[model samples]
Target: MTAEQQTLLEKSYKDFTRNGALLSDEAKEELRKIDAALAVVKLKFGENVLAETQAYQLHLTDAADLSGLPEGTIEAAHDLAKSLDKEGWIFTLDYPSYIPFVTYADKRELRKEIALAAGRKAFQANEHNNEKNVLEIVNLRHQRAQLLGYSSHANFILEERMAQRPEKVNAFLQDLLDKAKPAALKEFQELQDFAKKLDGIEQLEKWDSAYYAEKLKQQKFDLDDEKLKPYFNLAYVLAGAFDVAKQLYGLSFTEVDTIDKYHEDVQTFEVRDENDAFVAIFYADFFPRKGKRNGAWMTSYKPQYWKDGQEERPHVSIVCNFTKPTASRPSLLTFNEVTTLFHEFGHALHGILADTTYPTLSGTSVFWDFVELPSQIMENWCYEEACLANFAKHYETAEVIPMALVDKIKESASFQEGMATLRQISFGLLDMGWHGANPSLIEKVKDFERTQFASTSLYPDVADNAMSTSFSHIFDGGYSSGYYSYKWAEVLDADAFDFFKQEGIFNRAIGEKFKTNILAKGGTEHPMVLYKRFRGQEPRVEPLLKRAGLL
Candidate 1:
């Protein structure tokens, strides 16, 4: 907190944007010392993420313990429990175990208890409490940003994004909120009305959101995840994504067993061009466990670049929190999760297929706003008829998805677009509320968070539950003030998809242009230039608005 200490931290940053490869020989030596301290801190960081994902499992060895579980739940429980030296079943913090229990567990008290158990993490008086660690991380980040001549962390980060600066990010978030507020209000009213009528519930609580929303969606569209999940077995869904990529870009993938992986669950593949030459290595890690985080992300353990007279192939991994395969069933994906897989894999493809010369400027390492373009645009392919038929098939019958169901999926594509946009904008604004301002005057973190959510708060804040205490993205993760990039990239993705829709979703000319201009170029040039080179002009908001049915 001292000025002298702050200056030292700032000086060490050396400006990430201006300085290419800030880790030079001299800098690397200095960083070796910094890394020593960072190794200690990051060790705790990695351990906490792993512990949250892997540790503190629930072991139920008795068959009766699986009483209320869904069809395959008991099998998954037994398999997991047996592995951990139990009799009946094993349950951990994996999405398959945790999320279904949270949303559909018939036992309300059990759900609440486990929910509290999960929420209580990193807040209790123990080393796992990330509160102090979070504060330290934020302060360190502030110092790093200041070193780069930015007013705040948000300013430093957004400057290189499509949103350009904190001011622009704030403006974009607010502008979207202006458009989305009415739709959100209408959606909430409808959900509340439905809850009152169907469940005779006069009050809606935090727990009611997902449950009731599923109910409303089923009533409105005659569609629910369970009915659709049968058609979205993992291999089919991945094939659907692969088919879309091939149609759109002439890219191909072949399963390869030669590569080394950190875990047995990971499946490795070799990406290739139409001529069958090697492109990149793609690792897919699907399932929830203590070792993984709670969301989906695309990460490059090895980046694509030119070094030592050879272009190094990239290794891209897509880590997702999906339900593990139960005893009777393989992992079945909800349509939304299918889109998410497509999104992360799109990011993986961007990295794996990268043809760049510099590591810093490779794959999805472009501007924050533009980085989402490939991933988000790939979600578009999920809706195409040819695309779906390629991957969407009945798990048991092995029949391709019915065309009528594909039609239903497309019709429901914009079903909750307005409400979804509202949620995304609200989070981005919340991010701005924190890093965009001076927190010194704000002593209470909970009160500060409440104010940030004031304009968008649908459910009353649970006094015992504070989101800031556990918001890993803005605190320990790199998002901070840049969380708005999701929506920011939506604009780019939607617009870019329009170009493909005009030509053909799989037009090779356009795909090659995009590969050369956008994916392969990375951060070597301004994102706008790369975007325009591909789209032949600047991206537009109209396409996004149209896609969201807001127009």
Candidate 2:
């Protein structure tokens, strides 16, 4: 058998044995019950979070309450109210609504109200509360891990991951925390001082963080999302992403009419190589509706594999919840949304470029910690002048973005990065707190979370807010004990992008090396081995630290 086939077989065997294939029938029955209960509880946890998110709406009858909002945000809110048969504007906890309101809204009380509402999702005294669900999830996970002969759920999950142990994950997080905490404290203090000087505020609350930070960023860098949005119309940004793929990987995307789509909002494309050979089918869903969940992600409808001596291409999709275009304007993306588009498109490219034999080992089927490298690395391009020159054009005037603004975008890239790193570390530590040890004794989810967040706490704690209750990444989704993978992959992405910088952002040689050694290779080999083949060495943490401005 080929080495790839041997690796697949050995992995399959390990998966079975690790999942209790060798257990007695009675033990297996227990495992079955645990799995079944976990599925129900996890679904319930996500449903409750979504339902709670959908249930709340800050309805405003007076236009005075809409002070400090962007014109587009107000228009979107007005349209939402019109749809609901209401007289005034409406804003929900959805990111598209909530983010702009908090960051740009003038009314401090209103921002506080919405921010608190957002933080209290699934944590309130309501039918949708997830405290019990959180407790049950951790307890059941711990029980399952023990039953599977592991010390903890984290241990069981990490066994197949690049980290391979809870200790290493903890040490990695702690090392970052140690480097980041001092910087975060300084940044927090600076933000507080800035807020106080600007508004005569003695105390800076959670809601004030984004508002003041954005204000300070504008003050220091002369940049803000509002200034950059006109140049980042969604369609243009996507086309730019396609162009990047074309320039780097010889891929072309053409929208096709023959493909049946689940929704009219979804755009279907036939992806092909430079030689016009079929690569993959791509679908992009770029709006939010009544039933859609929040956030953006890339998913696969079909996997690429060799079958019957023929190559079966993959079907890939990227879904996002960008603000819809209003009647007066096109759908303009915030700078962050631009990066999000590139990130998901990067994942789509991974799936589209897969060249593996076994379906299980195909695109994005590698270590959990390694999966974010492609996505995160792609985000780096959004900040590059060479790349942004292709897509960053004003929708109204067709004007290319000024190099000055591009410089500002690059300058402000590390704005509040210290606090951001600390925030991520807090989540990683919280994940370990739940799964790295026995969670059966965790009596109160909020209390447990508070303990875990002790080292990373910035603002005063909100009595009504508990992040774990709605942290679906660990409870409802597949993160479980793997939330640290985001930072873990950042290390890889920053280092890998450094290599691209030394070569050239659009250097085809480096791009082909990345496509062959990483994206196309998938799970056929160890992630480090593949990464080394592309990068020529193990990744260095210094690159990530330098990028984050935490060094």
Candidate 3:
């Protein structure tokens, strides 16, 4: 235990020095002040974004305004309006309300209005605007990087990631861009042409993309999210994930109501090994609420570690905002939400399986680029017929998802994958453009973004809209120069899952190897070494490219 403590202390001290602790006493004092100010500024930046998101609302009294929205969406909107003591539907910037409207609403003008509102979230001239905040945040980051003897923020951040420098990150993104751009352009042209044919619209704008793409997908695959939702009820999907975990790792989960929960929607469970020994505590919070933030993520309240000759267990939680259960139905998840649950459950499994000696080096503390491999790889299971057979059944009828629908899901897995890859690459490139070089001379955020996006730009630009102002991942979150890691980890995940595919998907030996080698080991060694130890070879990009149909 003492040795373990010593190791953690050493790592913490090294990290502090690597950040800026070796500076002169005066410089160190200034660094402290800068960090304190940065904390306040970042907090304010996120708060401003949330406030702005909550502040805007499109209150509708006419049925025509709600045209083309899903029935579930209309019901939710009516509930919101009733709660607010209004007469008709109310739509906010929340994704549940916003996404369906943009994707299915027939009123292009309304879609344009909501999309423009979403895009220009913190870019407005109101008190919640983030223009000055963005400038100050980036300048402070650059200043901190220089103070730490790095040329730029990307250089400082990438030092600890799989991609070790700005140039390498840029090259990785560009290589993917070169492969994906042609296909992406062709896909865009097809989408535009489809919109023209379907609605007599001459040009398809950004707001029209999802609506048309969804329509086109239905036309091609004869599969839609609503048609698939009945088989993915939230409770059953959670059970499916647990079953997969059990089959893969010999773990079991049982709901225990005695544990205190933070919210009514949260479910608590006791995890156990095959021997019935306690493993970890898992909490799941699904469904959207006003207080909780958007997006799904896994977090650990107590990390698994060893001390005093005893192994402590972990408490892991997965939070998400799925479509809430309406008055007439259970909480049925869209196909995308099913994959999301699996993704986050994968992260929780990482925490639950942690067997490290030191808390600091425990689960999910690996390299930024490597941390996503487990989560993303788990998503692959959702597309498998073997896995889906366990828990994918209709909420009312109890009928399993048809083999035909499963086949369609697999067939359409890589549909328009090139365009999707290009979109992710664009975000990564934009992140690099901000942090890879000096942003000292960039006055207008939109002007700088236009240049960064020049290579990836497809549709006509919206003058009032800017992405940088609300790009929380790079600015307020830990992804500053690390957005590319999503793609970076995709490569790792594709390669890793290929191993499972080689052996049977449910091969116990392979599952045990993965749990012990990758999830349990955490940040104990360099990520590349850990990954190679598990896979027995360096990962090849061909697997990822092939999976995405880029090959």
Best by lDDT: 2
Q: Rank the candidates by lDDT, best first.
A: 2, 3, 1
Question: How far out, in Å, is residue 83 in model 3?
Answer: 1.3
RMSD to the true structure for each prediction, in A, is: 5.8, 0.8, 1.7
Q: Candidate 3's residue-wise lDDT over 1-551, tens digit each?
A: 45436557766887988767789998898788889888988888888888888888988899988777778889988999999999999988887788888888889998898999999889998888888888888888888888888999899899888899999999999999999999899989999899999999897899998899889999999988878889998999999999989998999999999998989999999999999999999999997887677788899999998989999999999998888888888888888889999999999998999988878899888889999988999999999999999889998899999989999999889888989999999999999998888889989999988999999988899988999888888888889999999999999999999999999889999999899889888777778888998999999899999998888
Report how far off residue 44 is in candidate 2 (Å): 0.4
* lDDT: worst 10-residue window of model 3: 1-10
Clash totals for all models, in order? Answer: 11, 0, 0
Q: Could you give candidate 1's per-residue lDDT for residues 259-345 as a string of tens digits?
A: 999888899988887888778888999877554678889899999888789878888899997777775688998788899999998
The C-alpha lDDT values of all candidates are 0.74, 0.94, 0.89
TM-score of each: 0.88, 0.99, 0.97
Residue pairs with backbone overlap in model 2: none
In model 1, which regions exceed 4 Å deviation?
Answer: 1-46, 49-69, 82-92, 307-309
- Model 2 compared with the native: what TM-score? 0.99
